[model samples]
Target: MHSSSRLFPVALVSAELRGDLTEDVYRLKPNNSPDPSVELALTRLGLPGREQRGAPVILVHGSFSNRRFWYSPRAIGLGPYLARAGFDVWIPEMRGHGLSPRNLDYSRNSVAAYARFDLPAIAAFVVEQGGQAPHWIGHSLGGTSLAAALGGGYLAPEQVASVALFGSQVSRDYWALKLPPVVWSGRFLLKRMGVIPGPRLRRGPEDEPIGLALEALRWYGLFGRFGERGNDWWAGLAEVRAPVLAVSAEGDRQDPPWACRKLFEQFGSEVREYLCLGRRQGFSENFGHVEMLVSKAAQREVWPQVLHWLERQALPLQANGAGGAAQGG
Candidate 1:
């Protein structure tokens, strides 16, 4: 196969196919409301309609993203595909982004908030709502949160079947969270200097929704650059004790092949897998930082591997929490 020329197939998403966004799908953490009213939005997609009917898989989006970002031309968005595969897909919009309420108290962003508020809230909700510990599939910042949650014990291993990360840097020179305060200060200065667009200015197609693009870029700026070689999720990988799959694009400047290799090595789980997708999968060589949920080529190349990995594990509802009826967020 001409990996460079191969065009991955993407399933078209129909308006009817779109899952309804409702508050009932989520379980918001108490007191944390108004500011971090962190909640996990659950929806039934794919072939099976029952929320608990399919293999439970949560699609944890990258920084500055919402649930809708997954629906792209090149990517079928795991929501629809996993749903079609008889896996109930739960898409969580991190706190301060998407429908999740913002921090009314703080003026600027805080990466730590996601680790403390969003990740836990979402994980607890999944368990409370009667779904099995899901297969956590994340991108960029989302991937980091998953690792932290696992490392910090915010989530238990039995609750998570496995993990799949796309274009995420666990620890490397370009790692985002480790950015020194000095670098952030410079970025703040750049923003003040009008070198960067204001909070709402956009760069993608005008017709396309600006929310995801803006959030993703904002995350990029806030987190700064964490090179491919700096990722270090070994602690979480070995401790979490779940199978993992890490995918990167050949030309992805943000998460080059080296970074993916590091994650694979540190996450020494025997079940772990890695793939270096090429640019022809769509997007440019710089496709390093975006969510595979938006990458059509990645959807075709990597998503199936995730699904297969999960199916091989197959955590039956009987083995998990007793099957329960689906509820609103």
Candidate 2:
């Protein structure tokens, strides 16, 4: 580990060898974020004996979810799947989700804070420990934050080997929310609630702070931009050069394929690919938003596709073409 990593106030909260994989949970308290008291939990998974065999892969879970989304309680999911496949996998829990306790400003947390502060810290810690830039894979809001980080230059291209977004989209055009009155009214009501009850709303595994909803409403509103600063995150996407893989499910009503494709098309990466899941695409079922990453069908059909994408990132860039090859299924 680097001396800088040693200096980072990260505690090893737990460690246990589960079957062929060793699961370790870490609590990182980086001083760079606005909330110094915020401790982010990162779960590391690797084969018991081949810890350093492959490049590190960071799995960022979507909103209303946590590390468990990547690696469920039963030891199934992409985290273990990647680890078993020889890659060093790290699953990070956004503040107040899963094992990470709520911070003082829990209710105030937004994607801007996550993109500007939390992500850089997570990247720094991963790089410090892995001794190399890691591949970033995110689902839903997790993917949106990664895109924001890249666009805002919070996470530089050199700091990331590649990026893969699953069921992630930023070009939200919900008719109901797009209206000015509805947007304003929704923001007001949500902010007053302080937080969204994910379980009650049937959204996901955990509650999402109202700040996130406000941010979303702002983005979906007319004349809304992504960054907390005056930065145009979508416009800024034209500058990101990292290899990207954008995945969308055919049946994902929450984030439709068209919107997901819009997000993918904005990326300026020389190496990028788009994959859509559906029966027509040879998938067993038309995968939904959550099913694209969490269901057993995903484990059987989609995991190998992800592994293939990661393996390709390790190869030398070719001159015949930039990496933006589009494919289906």
lDDT values of the candidates? 0.53, 0.84
> For this target, which candidate reaches the highest TM-score against the unseen true structure?
2
- TM-scores of all candidate predictions against the true structure: 0.65, 0.92
* lDDT of each residue in 1-329, candidate 2, tens digit only: 32235747888888998777889888888877777789899888888766355798999999999888888777899898998888889999998999999999999899988898889888888888888889999999999999999888889766799999988988766678768888878877886898899999988779999889888877867767766657888888889988998888889998998888888888898888787788766668899998998888988878878888899843222211222223522
Model 2 C-alpha RMSD to native? 3.9
The local distance difference test score of model 1 is 0.53
RMSD of each: 12.9, 3.9
- Residue 42 displacement in candidate 1 (angstroms): 4.7
Error of 2 at 179 (Å): 3.6
- Give the per-residue lDDT of model 1 (tens digit) for 1-329: 22111122111222243443211234244344345433333333444234346666777766546676664333256666766677666776664545555444433333444554566655655565445777888777677667656655556676777887777764446245245574556555544543233234552221222233332333445454322123322454555567777666666666676776676566646665565554543333334455444666557555665566578743223212222110001
Residue 147 error, candidate 2, Å:
0.6
Stretches off by above 4 angstroms in model 1 are 1-24, 30-52, 72-76, 106-109, 174-238, 279-292, 313-329
